[model samples]
Target: MSERASVPKEAEETESEPEQEPVTTGAQSVIRALENAGTDYVFGVQGGAIMPVYDALYDSDINHVTMAHEQGASHAADAYGVVTGDPGVCFATSGPGATNLVTGIADANMDSDPVIALTGQVPTEFVGNDAFQETDTVGITQPITKESYFAADSDTVGDDVSEAFALADAGRQGPTLVDLPKDVTQGETEVEPGRPETPETYEVPEEADDEDVQEAVEALAEADRPVILSGGGVIKANASSALREFAKEYEIPVITTMPGIGSFPEDHELSLEWAGMHGTGYANMAISNTDCMLAIGTRFDDRLTGGVDSFAPDAEVIHVDIDPAEISKNVYADYPLIGDARNVLRQLFDAMPRAPDADEWRDQCQTWKDEYPMDYDTPDDEPLKPQYVVEQFSEMTPDDTIVCTGVGQHQMWASQFWEYTEPRTWVSSHGLGTMGYGVPAAIGAKLAAPDQEVVCFDGDGSFLMTVQGLSVAVREQLDITYVVLNNEAVGMVRQWQDGFYEGRRMASEYPWIPQFDKLAEAFGARGFTLESYDNVEETIQEARDYDGPSVIDAHIDPGENVFPMVPSGGDNGLFALNEDQLDMI
Candidate 1:
């Protein structure tokens, strides 16, 4: 039996008490329930409506991290869950505070990160009166959250919180919210002081249907060129080893999505790197030419499948995912296996026959890799190339380092240049592509893995979006490296404007930029400025050697653009490569 199935069923249900105990406030019950749920940290800022809960938290063991913005807190909590595989917790006050968390909550929802958010509401009497700092949080968050709750009574505080955690960690995990009114938090009720009962485990199928497994196996066995397309689910399921073993047993090439960057070792023989908008030329070629495809844990988003009509037009697709709704939502799957990725892969491995000899196919792929290798040139001059800087940083950083990136040009460059060899080492804002995700996410990653080095590769525009998060790093004394690619413009937007909008640059360029080094000093953190490509290595080394949080502002070429990009709504073959990339190909 799989580990998930081995857990007792009773442990999955809400705990029930035999008798009511002494009177306790709703705020106290919330803190007690969170402790029972195994939450070690709570990220948020104190406010008027939520003061009682903060008072209760003062006596609890959970470490509270006060962020500069509620958005930062939400992102931090979401990233904590991504790294630890636990439901991250966050708190916010009423009105603006709760509204500020919307972006991060949506981010977690889109990425399927497990998060529990708690917000304060106006007193019950004034709920519909539009009182001071009152907003309909439940209505605002209903669309984005897995579940939303409004605490009507003090007695249900523990039950509501316990249920929220249960839902946040349940199937197709995402964010959950609880809105507690001021009266509810202050009200006293007869409740048990013990922890609420929650399910100890969730059961997933040990194996897929026998018929489906056999069909998939037959398809793979008969195909001349087969490929495995992995997504974030593999990392979430802790199935990298299983994925690698299955690929080797079948002599299949593995291509990952952006969120799935570290799902397979990029340096491995079977690894074809990422396949999507900014993916490797060879990986996209494999996608275009494969005869059979086995997709795991991916929804086949439009970005990955450039044109749904032409994506792998001739290939037979076999999709295995935990959610059945995703089976034929995009590309039709000839064989659909619905179960946990790890368990399904294990069963597939057991049912597979001897590995096939695809020497010709392997050679073809190698030829593609050699002919159109991902490359860039760095001139020995003043303004540095962001790609070259990232490449050098990737070489200097330890293998176990965790890299987090904000959305935009820098994110694409980091995804292209960094070779991720381990699972859960690369975290980023996908789906929503939110700017300002890098700094807070790095702080959360460092909190989850104190011994591992964490770096945030951020573009100037993205960095400034959540630059306030630097205060959290200084306050927590977290050792993180913030490398700002200072291009003085919204590079990705400008690239689009240049390509599609006839180079009408409107509000994309920054005429006056703050000196990041001085800003770091203002935050009581170390900082460095690098203008020349020659100083890249030594400056990074110095920042890494710093005891506390450090920010490195590297001025890069403002005109440099990411190449080998697939034009939006175009097929994989229609690549927008520059002159240098064309020469390499």
Candidate 2:
């Protein structure tokens, strides 16, 4: 037979045999990697460049939630991580989708939350060519993310995603990003159907040098008025129990930062609640007057320090944290211990003797707490007070209900009024102070603990920022109670304008006020408008009993401001209290 014709039909069939189904594509690898990493949920929105990954997601076991906006998805992911103590996963398409996530990513970064952000990029050929929907995600997220990765080839998809998760959940947890090109996602490759090699484990040192422990112990022993200043790190490290035990062992008063509100039980006898700007007068007073201050996991940011030169001027400071860079970056530490909060606290507790008698100091702090106890009174005829509403809500909600807040006056009020008995129950954008974070974060919190009630305390301005999230909540049928404290203004900015800008309202006031109840109804959620405080409790109960999402628009005092406020950069002693309440303190 002629050589060309002699090719066996069987040989031709063998050569043309359909190629084995690809073991994996870049997209499939990404999804499988996440599944291997134990990711239960992913919050994101689909788009052109990311369609391939979304297609892969459709077949995966992971639960995917499509949010109204990328920012909402990011915040939702942020809360998921905060509540679960795992890296929350978020995906976004290129360009505007990626850019919209910046604020939420920055929020995670500032607060040290472990969030994994995955963004789609244009094909490799178009990466630098300014193609449609193309942007340098790695470059854009560099400053905000703990680490950033770009998967230039299909082979790196799994490795890059695995590394991003590892980095996000590792020491000093923060957001991490992985950028995947469209072509890569569409490319086929043979990938093992198993988890990647486990990343190196980070263990907090169990023991501190004897001398360092002695130094800290001696500092505590010598000081009559000792205080423990806790921060978000306590919660992040899952060391709230350790912190409480340490405080009890030392009989030291514990004051937390705003982000650390629930780190220590507010109802604890030793608890000084929160300190720094908008902190209780007593907590700030204790920080300013302590003879020895042991700050753990706190960066002592300008907010906490107020006037750095004047902060804890009289106190000998012992700062402990995992990151050495934060040890003395802002406030100088007399003794710096670099280690994990839980591990270090455990060691310190074991090393130290029982705290010396400091009854007089303790009593003095108690007196301050009594004198300036958080209080707000509302006249029967006066418009409903936001503080009262929060107090009632706090009282009525389940003890473990997760409370999330949008930024501004409502945030400070929630921090002050709500009694957070558990860690991770209080969620908010502390560092970035991003508005419109509450609703979506609450959604994430609800998803994290489906049985737990998730309530969002949002302001009029803040609720408007992400009101569209209501549609998602309704679609998912999440039983979330959103309380809008409607003052019809950017209350916090207006407060500042009133206090510092000679009452120039400027752009702080909202020209048009949308009926939040109507808006909620339009979004297919139950709605209630409370113009009076007479039935506040009843309304809350009704909303709580409702089987799905509900919005309660409670008209609050427009002029009310957060009290015991220390002017920015001003000493704690410069607290501005209501005129009528000043004498009580």
Candidate 3:
């Protein structure tokens, strides 16, 4: 914001001009490296120390989207990476700016998202002096990142960014950090203007041991109630095709973990309806009864697996993941597989010996699906209904479009409504349910995959937290659809209040009705008002058809809650809403 952000440091300005034909500072060199890496956008909150870097970005092709909070910037980048399978980049200042990126970085690390964080550090000479805007960012972020580098020497800025991208986009991709000291950022250097070498290829064991594959095949063949648990790895490893093939050949029910939500079709008969907390009862029951389980690209996080100790007690797990660390990280594996999930499955599919006919296993899962189909009535409920509108939104979009969400009640509703037919179609801060994530994340997703329609299902309260990003979308002219389920309250918290706090509406109201349509228009974006459910569909269809940013403000009952509630701290067995709760309904 300050002109200082556009000025190179006095130290750099005073540096001896390079003897070469043309000379560029380390800032320009780093920018070029990013450009070479195909980084088209950078999410950030600029600051004093990073001014030189910002200066280079002026009219340099790549655009920067400043977020309200640094965390939003990081998360937006994280979501972008997940959506596009490209390394996403975020910039921040030192100290608080760096600290703000912690939660989002941790989320990406936990989920193995490919994110690159570029942070400005105090001058190298000021290191450990507790200099203004100085913090031990690299040390602070080490535990949560796949790899991190701090370049105290300005001469190495380009290389640092280069290596950061390599680590972020390499095998089993995750977060990578580059802390560039202010002094170093200003330093001039002879940078090799070149392409990065491809990361060394690692062999993904295609053929599971014939005996082991046969054993797994026999176990699956023998079980009448077999199930497959897919995870993010399935999508990351591009195993969706193989998973579909295996599921089809075996004819067993295949459900996914939260991150793996869309790896298997929600509409698939073999789907156990997303097994874990907040999932379907029949799916849980199918998990309970299945004697054979195939877990791919999943860590079986607690949310997905009720309790690791008791999870699939009767089943033999055929665990396959690209990362060896994930094989027994959560649920124990009977036949541990360490390789690319897609590659492993491809081999399994080809060498797959005949398994028992799936007539009955598929039949049981189908029966469960038919019996416990997820449902909610029209937009006619108190506290504005969640599912009705979410389902409506889902019905409005094409199957290939993406639906990213913040981690909250609306996220859960989206899980129930929008059925993901492909991987990376639905992204959220699952392990770390951070608010204020939707808008910026939508920006990143739109940048990463401009052709695909990316929508953010934002809760009213959540949207307010990061509403500043609505401007970013408009400024960027991002083709993103924002369908805010306006409960006029922290819907998730209000739900907890209704169920746990005796329906006492304390501080859970957004008294100021945010004219989101006007706000979007204020930023020169298309906006719509669907005050009544009768016009919700038309409004959404119009928004979808629009070529630019759009916001559909659908105001509904405030007391309506996301049902099938698993009371906080309760186990999956205690879910509150189901056919059993229908009597109360």
lDDT of each: 0.85, 0.86, 0.76
RMSD of each: 3.9, 9.9, 6.9
Which residues of candidate 1, in runs, are more than 4 Å off?
1-23, 193-207, 579-585
Model 2 per-residue lDDT tens digits across residues 386-415: 999889999997777889999999998988
Model 2 TM: 0.94
lDDT of 1 by residue, 179-241 (tens): 999999899976743443334564545457988998888888788888899998887777888
Sort order, lDDT high to low: 2, 1, 3
Which candidate comes out best when scored by lDDT? 2
Which of the predicted structures, 1 or 3, would earn the higher lDDT when compared with the native? 1
TM-score, one value per model: 0.93, 0.94, 0.88
lDDT score for residue 455 of model 2: 91
Q: Give the poorly placed runs of model 3, Cα more than 4 Å off.
A: 1-24, 58-63, 66-68, 193-214, 379-384, 501-513, 567-574, 578-585
**Residue 537 shift from truth in candidate 3, angstroms:** 1.5
Q: What would the per-residue lDDT of candidate 3 be over residues 379-424, giving only the tens digit for each residue?
A: 3444346676777777777777778887677888888777778777
Worst 10 residues of 2 by lDDT: 1-10
Q: For residue 259, what is the lDDT in candidate 1?
A: 83
